[model samples]
Target: MSEAWNEGYFTDVGYTYGYYREINPVFQRFCLLLRGLAQPEPAEGTRHCELGFGQGVSVNIHAAANPGRYVATDFNPAHAAHARRLAAASGSEALLVDESFEQLLERDDLPQFDSISLHGIWTWVSRDNHEVIAEFARRHLKPGGIFYNSYNCFPGWSPAYPLRQLFALHDRFGVTPNGAVERVEAALKFSEALLAANPNYLKAAPQLTERLKSIATQNRHYLAHEYFNREWNCMYFTDVVDALAPAKLDWACTASPLDAVDAVNLAEPAQTFLKGVDHPILREQARDYFVNQQFRKDLYVRGAIRLSVAEQREHLLDTRFVLTQPADQVPMKVTGALGEASLQEDLYKPFIEALAADACAPKTLRRLAAGFSGMAWPVLQQIVAVLTGMGAVAPCQPESAEREARTRCRALNRHLCERARYGNEIEFLASPLTGGGISVPRFQQIFLLAREQGRKQPAEWAQFAWGMLDAQGQRILKDGKALESAEENLAELTTQAGEFAEKRLPVLKALGVV
Candidate 1:
């Protein structure tokens, strides 16, 4: 593998096979709708693009689960190949390219994108690459299209910047000619030793101790790319706003749904102070400092359209939502910049229970609101927003879109489950209901595979899964310890299979993944 093609980007190891939901167009539209901003619908002919789509997990899933055309690029050929494989498996109309940002900028055939997204990219590339992206967006993004950009931001990264620099420095100067993984381990070791020395820097940045400790335990591949990269720039929120201004972008709202809720993230005084700040940029920057914000998932609009209160209410009522997790598993407390706050039980309890009813099928806000005769529309909307922000509930695509996506999602999910028989690297399945990926661990995926093959009982699913694992000489790990014998492993699998059948299968069925 040659390094020249990667520019300064780290290509020593493939990036993680993680699915980020923020890249989903359905999720992005909901984020905008939450802030009373208008975004393009995820209609059949809509176009979306993702720059630096690492493992292509999100792009593929979105392509399969949503009714749209997806075009994505990652400089890494290995990533592009893996992504393309998933695209092929799902029979999705996704164009995954192995082209640099500069190359992508030179292309004239790209369609006008309704949404353009780049996650964990802005801060890791050079200023020139940033310009290329802006130019790309300027030329290709349609008017009123959404542009999602997530990056490591300032003030919050202020304390940890030095630590990252140390890791990069160690990898550059102190490490020997070892593999990327070994080099990462060595850099972590050096950082740990330096922190153990209890230097003055550690005393000034007390958080560094815990941060370093946490870093040591993270995936080496992630650490290598995250810290050992040659170009890592942590910018402020305002800087990003300015950088993308060339593309006619206006800051719309955060892709993080929870940030929309002021009560969870901002105190009354802080909120008042931010409100008094007349400039949007200045207010956003001040809010970041107030929250000590680090990484941000932001959605920008080329031509911003503010929805009227009545219009916002109308659109929200038409939108559909589904619970992403089991109702009982969703915690009543949500943590934000203000720490943990308890959700109003009287408001959320009945709502969650109601959502969980009807076999946990997707429900329109209007229908759900009808069930709560006494609750006001505003209160119901707020409750939906808070639950959505908590990640327990998720907005769904239009019913027509979901129906169109079922074949693609099932194909993609079957491919994922088949892959799970060998490895657990990819741990999510595309869900047409939510228009995103759902967390289905490898065993659960195997269980789904068994069900697909006409296995009727959980016991049969357990046996089927056990057969696959036992052939691979793998044992069931219960509570961090591997089962010693076949009977123990089968017993553990049986219990898991039963729980999966009882808890997750119905939801998966509703999501059209089963």
Candidate 2:
């Protein structure tokens, strides 16, 4: 709790309980294969390390859902305690510690990790810490291993830099309470008032007005850490590559599946221009300017490996995918720098419907393409890529891995569902099939608990949930207003439970969460 231990990092408020899918090894491998790059194979002894694993949600989920060893650390003791508790409940055997990056670097007991990841930590720390991280990666990352990192980047943040500076200045000079939330509220109020005064700076940068308005609507806890941090830096793509050079890291591809699809992200002219740019690093950084990219999720490798066309095709056929949402409900369009583009329903619909069959089961590209006679292999591949980018589908682990991870997944899911009875802070459940967290809301988790307790009908499940809620003086909200009577709350809950049983329960069952 001491400020000295926090170094420049924000510790007055805890980080959000968010589950980032990019940290999952199964997703990382799929992203690599999409770009014709070699990835670390999913094996029984795979090891992963995460730096600054806030709330430990993603690390815990991955440890329980995948057959591997996970070692992670967050400097905040509160975060480490929460993460360790989840690991214990799942029986995941993860090693979580509350040590700073420099402290972690001094340890001698860590294994050579197949993957090393840090999300949203690169830009918020000092340059010395960055050096520590690069040195840590250099010492612990195995040859040909993957390194995942996400950070706020340049060009997109160029105009918004002044706005953040103003916030930091106000937090330093303005009268405010000691609490992080209070400081954030006061800074936002000052910024809003300053924008209303029509200053000359606002005249030069018109976009800051709208951006500040949007920032005001975000989670206060998120805004506190994001804007009020003591040390903040943004870099260009080339700068990041240079920073990690000591680790012998080469840029591989983006962890975001959508970035791999040029058709969606780049205009024809932009694509042609990028093709003419010979340097890979220059081309990637140039592409960012066209899109005004602020945030990036990137993948780097110790030693880059290029896959041949024949091998790429062979791997595609063997990889499996599963629908994360309902087939019919999936959007027929994807948005990117080019704006919204419509997907060919004739191509995507049949593929989605096939996977949705047999209770939304997982299927390989070879088995799926067999159903369609004349579809080309490239087209099928693109379909999967686009669907994955839209978050409607996810790459799945092999059956052997899923079977081995099922017990751990079940234990974590049970623990999460039981916690849902008290609060809705965490809203994801581990899935053995996907080797990642799936978005299952709090009420749905409550329904899962009801079913496990032998409640069969929707009415029975609703009644069970109501008893838990009513005991704590909680009421269901309808149309943004709390239902005043128990009857109204029960009716609303029953309707929701009925829809859950019909639509979501089947998918959860297939994911082995039910």
Candidate 3:
């Protein structure tokens, strides 16, 4: 039997350092604007709460990047303690606790939340927990506030459901020994051999084999908690809408802004056909069938207020943004329901070039529009919106958020870099300029830590990291094999350091991460 903690969710193996965009109030408002939905004003300085904040990476980063009075709860004490450690190190005043949803709702001292977000909370736990979460939203969330919820939705999950069940069954009844990771590997190994025998169901749905292969490469801790949980609910869009209705929550838009663009998300006839559906839930559910979306990140608003065209544009223009990647790196194509669609080069070229020219200095839509004078306002808005959704660009901290975020980011990043020498638990660092954490691989984290101690060149950075590893009595791995000697490890680090310096350093510098 599983532990009573988190209602049988894993506490033994902690969740990964995950970050979700919906938790950032600035980004949330931006995505809602992209979908033409009226959003509550929640810049830094507002109250935000995240339920089931696994590992607390997102909450901590957002807290460090903005001036928000943040609050979060993870039932697992280990997760909460780790999150609190990060907060304390960054000098963030975020109130992070280890409390269940029921206990939290009953607390009299907690403030009413301006925004409530749960990243994939709805898909993992019991229906009782789900209703409790809904009740928390109803009581604690202020009027006209935002609620971000992500989950496993049907049709997209239809193919993998049986495979998950197979893994779970093997864990329960089969002779599994030792830890969860061993059981997961054994279950997977058994499934592979059984499927190779060419059963009828396996033969019919070849997608199952592909899914298993993808699942094989994921973090074992993620897989264990995700699949081994007692309650693994994959509900339809309508089911989710109904579940939140009692909280007086109405679906506003997708938490991911890119999903709002119909041209990229759905093909012509199907997109046109779906437009005819008047009900929001039915329309969303119908779209899911077209895209075969396995996961969903949705935004709901309590008492949603619609924005006028002028008001919408005014709000969108005020949101500051920064370019995170090189102009040449931007993808020219996107996948739609019909097929892959190509983005027009002419429209994106000028914008990308302009952003690349300035690097880290975040510019507003109004400032960006001045450079693309030839392009119409709506077209520029649409392209930028799509690009932001695609992750080529991001909504950034306003002037008000920058100085404070930068200071906190430095403190948090230095702490994270130092921690990397000991373990690989945290792979994220706060960047006050970017107002978020970018994925910093363990190797790169070591490199950053080395660079901090007066190591200017990449080779020096490589040598410094090698010394740390050598001191730790650890060897570096390449192609799943540990190097034989310190010399070979140093050689490997040199190459990686050169590439990182050339490609990643500029972005990191702009983000105030280095």
Candidate 4:
């Protein structure tokens, strides 16, 4: 722990633009449904909390998009302010606290959370913080509540272990007293230079050299948080399970729907070997080894009451889905540990097409299945699950939360779109339909804002954005080169805006991104 930094976790530059869908209850539950797991729905005004809610993007979006009460804390007041600002902009009553984990755990007035999520911060803090978090989960999380924890795990980060240490050590002893980012940049250059020296360590770990190269191209702020931190630990699956055991939180299925399918994550031999081992935690560790899984996004439950098979089928059938992207545009090829698996066109094409048509009024699995004829419940579930996991589709929110979420989303999006004029640090907009954030790029956000302010044509939208850019002395970059002429930049913006109007406008309207 550096005496200069008061906050335990990295806060010098804050976290990068990241949104984890596992934090959204609607999407998270929908993912759980795919694995035949039962998660309690938002009935009792489902109270939720996220520890170290970086930028508060995930929690703010979740609060705005769902009809639940959210209470989240980030130690850094700066990060908390950003989260609070977004929450306020959305008119959401999300309580964002700038308090440490220990402070939060010591508070007695806080409500017990129905669900809790902490992503990317677990291994970055000291063991004391980890213990505080576990205690917080044990005390503040209600029985049967789901806990989401994502961290840099072992086997995957194995090759880069020494490289991370090298960067941190270099930054500590050699770098000038400029700031974290410059120190990180210097450390990166030093590491690359060392790799050029062709040392025995670099020879033994060829992957670390490639990792160092990749880091140089990444955001230095992100690099500062990821590798420049003093307290960083990447543990194995068993370590996480052991840490959370006192909280009575057992490992549930992974939050990723694609990972529910064994065929993709494990090789055939590994899959066969896993079947014999009945201990869930050990089995997962074994799978992690097989896939060399460096990171994990997992869902744990405290006294989970699993639904019966029939109940699961009925509930799944009742759930609805809308296509996020065009049916034809949805890539059939999905990449995972097994490399690339091709989705069967004959089966998936029709399913995707169905959702594409029903974007406005998404169809349930049972209703959608009727069109395919003879598609059984399990197969339908699998296909939809896989598609949702592939990021092509999303589950539709209940009608009760729809109007309220939309109102909040509209308010929040208006503020976000306004921010796009300056820069695109945030790359997500709250989607009322899915009760989650949608990946809307900066330009699209500007276009949506233009449309909202009476710019009917794409040319007009392009002109409006170009005016802002020119006024700010910002030029559009193409192929790592800025367009010298204003006319050339506007021409490029016009072409992109035109495509957005023709192709994406309808989908945005249907999904309520605008």
* Best model per lDDT: 2
C-alpha lDDT score of every prediction, in listed order: 0.90, 0.92, 0.82, 0.85
Q: How many backbone clashes does candidate 4 have?
A: 1
TM-score-based ranking: 2, 1, 4, 3
For residue 179, what is the lDDT in candidate 2?
A: 85
Give per-residue CA lDDT, model 4, range 396-473, as digits (tens).
877777776888999999999999999988889988888898888899999989999998999999999999999999
Off by over 4 Å in 3: 43-45, 335-341, 473-488, 495-503
Q: Model 2, clash count?
A: 0
- Between prediction 2 and prediction 3, the one with superior TM-score is 2
Q: Per-residue CA lDDT of candidate 2, range 141-205, in tens?
A: 99999999999999989988988898889988889778888899999999999989999988779
- Tens-digit lDDT string for candidate 3 (262-353): 77777778878997999877888888999998888888999988888888888778877776665677899866555778899888877877
Best-to-worst lDDT order: 2, 1, 4, 3
lDDT computed for candidate 2: 0.92
**Residues 141-163, candidate 1, lDDT per residue (tens digit)?**
99999999999999999998999
lDDT of 2 at 174: 89
> How many clashes does each candidate structure show, in the order listed?
0, 0, 0, 1
